[model samples]
Target: MSTLTKSNHIGRKISRIRELKDMKQEALAQALGLSQQSISNIENSETIDDERLIDIAKVLGVSVEALKNFSEDSVINYFNNFYDESAKGQILNNSCSNLTFNPLDKLIEAYEENKKLYERLVQAEKDKVEFLEKILKDK
Candidate 1:
């Protein structure tokens, strides 16, 4: 397949999976550390990089290969299961008819928290390495 066609195929699959999960583009963008426009571009088959594809796969809890090669029927089937499970989880979590928070909202909050934690951890590791280097230099 041509590169554009391949990218379009992947984009369509990503879009389908995101919709299946009842996730907004903004939420996916946050999970992927990308802008909403970037997600839009990918969905519209504009341009996307391999790193972005990997990130999308990671956020969607799917394999990169699966995201890249998912057939339409398979995607639809997966979406049905995904929606059913999410609905069940929601019902279990909230006994009342009213929901205090939307699932996507909670997901975005969790993703943002995780992203911040990761950044902090990375900074701490870098600082530790720098400190070790300085101590060695002093010795």
Candidate 2:
């Protein structure tokens, strides 16, 4: 049987790293201030610019060199070494409870954004009211 050789694909590396970190496309998109469709397009791309690559590395919590030199073997070895108990025939209970980023942090960020937006909207309304009141007084 013939074996399939993979190309040196940077997109695949980013995708794999993202998956290993248990991050969804939407989360990565949010962190990068990009759309989920943009993330998907990036993953489907074979190459990325250096500056953007740096941003992606920062978001993924890895160095640019690490992304360039990413390999399945290295990742597998890392995991194998991480869970030493797994070598002893113990089943690993990998659960969703083990999230890379804190949910509370995201919630707080959302709350702060919403608060700022609401404040802006309220101020705009107040300005409109004040302008109308001045017009009525003039009339």
Candidate 3:
């Protein structure tokens, strides 16, 4: 008789959302000006006041409704389908996409940057030698 209703554990939802956002309890506590122990207590709570929940939502950068509606299954689904509709149904979430990126072009760009740096270094050495020559001539 106890298995059908959805869980309304607001604190648990908050905890999950915080973890998904890569935030630690200590960081969240600092944002809310509360101690870590207080954050722990809040997470262990089954329900939070509306005002407190709104404050937590602000710190987490989510709407209060988003916090309340957070679900592990939904998150998993969202990440598992990370392609944009404009991609023509191409799976663009990883390196397996059929994009036209040339590694040789990237290598050439790196070489050009390195050549500029080498030129700068050589000019600096020449400048140092010139300064030293001036000093020796003065002596």
Candidate 4:
């Protein structure tokens, strides 16, 4: 891919990530203080400003680098190739449906990690609010 195409691919990656998280464009727009149409435009753009990318990543609960480099196919391929169940006699039918890499455990683990991270973010926000309130009361 050319540099321009590669840059545009980042927008697609962001769109995919948002979809995977079950987040609507309207919700993302609300978080970014933008309109849904604006979010659509951003997803169709070739590039985004670094600061804006950071803001979007924060709203998505992911790192900016993750947004930049995320690939759904890579994750699927990794799981598909990581385990060979047939070789271990786990696949008796030898059917495509019986082919199992068993990525559900990893997905669950990632979900738990994200939940903890979200809780930490919420606590940090609460702490910031309390600090600000304490300062106002002191004044």
Candidate 5:
């Protein structure tokens, strides 16, 4: 393939993988410690540095070679060649449909719990300050 074609292919593959992972470009940028613009440039097939490519691959949990050379057939072939029936069964068993609660719902619940705990901590700190002031006044 031409360099431009390869670059575009890589960009599309990255975009697809990012979507499958349910990540935005900004989120992927944050994970890779890169700017959103850099991610945008990458998705546009602009030149990217080798280190950044490695970082992207790491973030996407794939090899740099895979990122560079992936085609739809290769992906399908990979699943066909590497995935066993037992592994497929395990994947299904651990799939999102088997989950009791949506992951986002769990995250929101945890966030609310953390917010309430922080508020209680702040109130306790204020009460402690008031108690200390009263003790000093009585000294």
Candidate 6:
């Protein structure tokens, strides 16, 4: 099924998440008490053990479900709706003097983070396609 396919690329998802977090293989290795080569192999592996995946996700500051369900389009859609509703609230409550904290700054930070992730996701997809094409050509 399409749903299964979308959630199946565990290694790719981990690599993308690491890149989006601005982490290097060496950094993740350090966090997990692994060598850089081990981290590299993990990222290249098609399947990883559940416990190892959980540890890696913790080092990456994400949940296993997030890694499994990650899709750039879904992230973009979530932020779009979130910011739209946020803007509407601000517009409707422009005169509300009771609001103590400003959330726009945090929202902007999240948006920038998402933008970086989107760019990395696009590059990763391109790299995957090129890798597949290379294998096909070699065969």
All candidates: TM-score? 0.50, 0.61, 0.57, 0.52, 0.49, 0.55
Best by TM-score: 2
TM-score of 3: 0.57
Query: Which structure is stronger by lDDT: 1 or 6?
Result: 6
Q: Which stretches of candidate 6 lie over 4 Å from their true place?
A: 1-7, 82-139
The lDDT of model 2 is 0.90
Give the range of the ten consecutive residues with the poorest summed lDDT in model 4.
91-100
Model 1 lDDT per residue over 1-139, tens place: 6646744466778888888768999999877777999888898874458888888887887788877777776757876987898988753334344655588887898998999889999999999999999999999
| Candidate 3 C-alpha lDDT tens digits along 61-116 | 78999988887788877766653443567645454354355768967976986798
Residue-level lDDT of model 4, residues 24-99, one tens digit each, is 9998986787999999999988688999999999888789988987876676775576566546756454334653
Which runs in model 4 stand beyond 4 Å of their true positions?
1-8, 78-139
lDDT of 5 by residue, 19-138 (tens): 777899998986766799978878877445788788898888678887877676776776675567566565334455565557799689769867987999999999999999999999
Query: Alpha carbon lDDT of residue 135, candidate 4?
Result: 100
Q: Mind giving the per-residue lDDT tens digits that candidate 6 earns over 6-114?
A: 5566888899889978999998987787999999899888789999999999888788999887777786897798789888875533534664547697578768867
Q: Candidate 3, residue 50: CA error in Å?
A: 0.5
Per-candidate RMSD, Å = 10.3, 6.1, 14.6, 10.3, 9.7, 16.1
The Cα RMSD in angstroms, rounded to one decimal, for candidate 6 relative to the true structure is 16.1
> Between which residue pairs do clashes occur in model 2?
none
For model 2, residues 50-131, the per-residue Cα lDDT tens digits are 9999999999988999999998989889787768878788877776667677879978998997798799999999999999
**Candidate 1: which pairs clash?**
none
